[model samples]
Target: MSVIAVNDGTFVSELEGKGVTLVEFGAVWCPPCKVLLPILETLSEEYAEGLRVLKVDCDESPVTASRYGIMSMPTVIVFKNGEPLEKLVGLRPKSAYTNVLGKINAEAARL
Candidate 1:
């Protein structure tokens, strides 16, 4: 699956009130942000059962970006129960995301 586009309207209810949310804040102009799209998509597909992966374009959704203090481009925030659990800045390997998903899955299993 592809990354879901999120905005101020849906950010809170969809991310905070729901289950795990992996939100990526980025701008279309950023090269690194462009590069991370595929990885986000892959991760979204891999964890579709338990995780909600979305993208908030900094240009399109400034309110959501500022709410999270997104100073840099391509900031990845992982949220559980509406609060942030992890923030990954810059470009990272696919394994970096899978590791986080694995951890969340383990925790979910325990719960």
Candidate 2:
């Protein structure tokens, strides 16, 4: 599925269900945020069965950004069961993302 663009109004509801949700907090003008988009898209496709990837434009969603304490561009947070599990700041390798997902998947399997 395509990455859903989330705003302050939709942020909580977007994260309030079953499955794993990956939310990327970013701004339109941030270069690293631009760089991370495709990487997130690819991961979203790969984990489509169990993952939901969403994006929150910090410039447009200040309330959501502040709620999450997002102090930098391209901050990726992994949420499971409506709670954050892992956070990554700046640009990172695909493996960095996969590693976090792997752990979440494992935990999910145990439940």
Score candidate 1 by lDDT: 0.86
The backbone clash count of each candidate, in order, is: 1, 0
Q: What's the CA RMSD for each of the models?
A: 1.4, 0.9
Q: Clashing pairs in model 1?
A: 16-82
The segments of candidate 1 whose C-alpha lies over 4 angstroms from its true place after superposition are none
| Per-residue lDDT of model 2, residues 1-98, tens digit only | 87899899989888897579999999889999888999999998998868999999999999999999999989999998799989998899999999
Worst 10 residues of 1 by lDDT: 10-19
Question: Per-residue error at 89 for model 2, in Å?
Answer: 1.0
Which pairs of residues collide in candidate 2? none
My TM-score estimates for the predictions, one after another, are 0.90, 0.96
Off by over 4 Å in 2: none
Provide the overall lDDT of each model, using Cα atoms, as 2-decimal numbers: 0.86, 0.91
Best model number under TM-score = 2
